[model samples]
Target: MKKMVYASLLFIFFSTLFSLADTTVLKPSKEEEIRDTIVVHGMVLHGRVTGIGPQRLSFKLRYSDGTNRIAYKDIDSIYTKYNYRISFKRMDIEGRIVGIEENKQYLKILEGNHERTVKIADIDNFIMAVSEDDSFENVVRNKFPYTKGSIHAGLEVENGINRKNTADVRLNLKRKVAEHETRFFLNYNFETTQTADEPKVQNKDELIAAATYKNYFENEQFFFASLAAEYDRPRQIQQRWLPSVGYGYKFTFDKAFWLEPAVGLAYATTQYTDIQYQDDQFTAAALRLSGEYLMDDVIYINTLIIDGNIMYYPSLTAAEEDWIMRSNLGFSIPLFDFLSVKFIIDYTNDSNPDPEVGNNKTTSSLLFGFDF
Candidate 1:
């Protein structure tokens, strides 16, 4: 009888222990309980917030195929279950975004049951959430601010009555942090031709470099300044400088494309490499009219991308017939996650050109490159 009683007691104790263990195992951790959610145009998106900008929000969709980058005014609301480190002009806060007041231009954050309101204009930066296992070293190494750039190169060789070799390299770098955006561009091309009657001769050597900066403001209006320099040996242009400043507005048409039209005053000066072309050198005030366009997933095909820009400088101080126009267009198709094949066409026209070289120049290239 004593053995039977002891056995019953032991079984009850083990059972109780097992039940507690099972209960503990079924409980979820805080990370598993929290999820990031965004509501835009009545559509609820369950995803991780990749970035927050003054005018836009970048989201990594949980159930979608592509990233969602929408203007702040378009997003109805956002909620972050985990704490995100948000920076302002003079202070920083660690909290979750509970609400977004688009009309009032403010954000409601929850910190330890206390709600605080912060103006959108006061925000300087927004970083993604940090994980429990994330150390300071790892965060710095993994989440450091970086620029996006691409390098494209192409070569063409032909053999016939005249052997011709042509090569070109182009580089583009872009960085957008908060309200400031910057871009840098470089392109170089070389060509050589050899005839059976003569030795090989270099016919083309061209280099172009340009840098632009923009300070964004409300309602897609911004202030922009740019400077560009060019050298074309084939055209007898030793150097050319273009500096412009202007006010511009961006028009976003849905999520597929945008167009920006800008008008401003500019100054252009040219130096000729040939002594006989000295008369062509001139510095003059000009009216700068430029337009830029970008389209992604063209026609919803999801693989084609098109981007281009056109700049027309009509000389104000120089003769009426001495205007210049430059236009570029590019088409790209992604071959991999980071690699793409691009075809580009560049055209330049100078109303006044060296008598030896023509007034129009056109170049096209097919290049392969990867973006980082």
Candidate 2:
């Protein structure tokens, strides 16, 4: 009996060793293997639907390609996970998928006319189905480019102690030269003012022609420069011709907030019909600093802005030599992609004493304008 028990123990130990060796040598089945090769046709399974159009549907299809893994535009009539049947006008296109989140799907087509990726997850009926057509890659390559023009019209009101109370009608036209980077702007502003000491003021107009260049620079730094020529016709004073150069720089934080610092210089000369006040030539320099926080793509909340300017009269006689300083504080809000409305308070002071008029005045204005 002792020899039999010893023989049984030896048999059990060898059996266990043999079983371990067999388990170590086992291989995976065909269905469990990963595939790397591209596969043209496979039955659609569980995947996300990313885009929908009037005549098209776009989604991603995941499947194994015999050797590893592959993904492509599944533009086929495949059943969605929810059980509705869907079809595409195209299929098997290559594109990047962007913005994928829980219960959300987005895909971008890198090729053809529809280069933009779209998001679609709200369609209720078509959960699972299959249909096919062209590929998204071919469609995105054929989009066309075009230009657009627009007009702005608004009313402005201003009141001041030493200056006249004014009401104005404003009109402007702008055309886009390049999608969002460059533009041509033309402005015509006309105002009428009334003062207690002066005669009724009428026909104050400023005509401005300007061209602007924009740079989408590095590190969220954006720069813009413009050259402008203007004719200012005042009912009470001589008409003036001014040429100005200005540049602005803005540093953006994330996509929503930015700080802009700007400077400008202007050379102006007046033409007189009566010469009651000497026709003079002057140089004006201006500085502006502002900060804007974007609430959204279309809305901006102004945090702060300070604008200051100095005017030097170079052609005046010794007795009439004078300088003027002006400063403004304002906030602007955009109403549309191209239109904005502003509220501003301005203060002005002159160095020369005019016995009839005070040296300082405060004014308020409401302005509406547009950008191309």
Top candidate by TM-score: 1
The CA lDDT of each predicted structure is 0.75, 0.43
lDDT of 2 at 249: 72
True-structure Cα RMSD, model 2: 19.9
- TM-scores for every candidate against the unseen true structure: 0.64, 0.40
Residue-wise C-alpha lDDT for candidate 2, range 1-372, written one tens digit per residue:
999999999999999999998986686554334211122355434344433432234334345221111223333223222212221222223333332232324433333334543443222222222212123522221111112333445565666753443443334333222223454656555667667687666554656555655553543344555554445444222354555445667665653455666666655555544446566567666344556553322223422223332322222333245444445555556454346676666565543233344556665667776633
Task: State the lDDT of candidate 1 residue by residue for 280-348, as single tens digits.
Answer: 443444334333344433454445667887878777766566766788888887555356789999998
What lDDT is obtained when candidate 1 is compared to the true structure? 0.75
Steric clash pairs (candidate 1): none
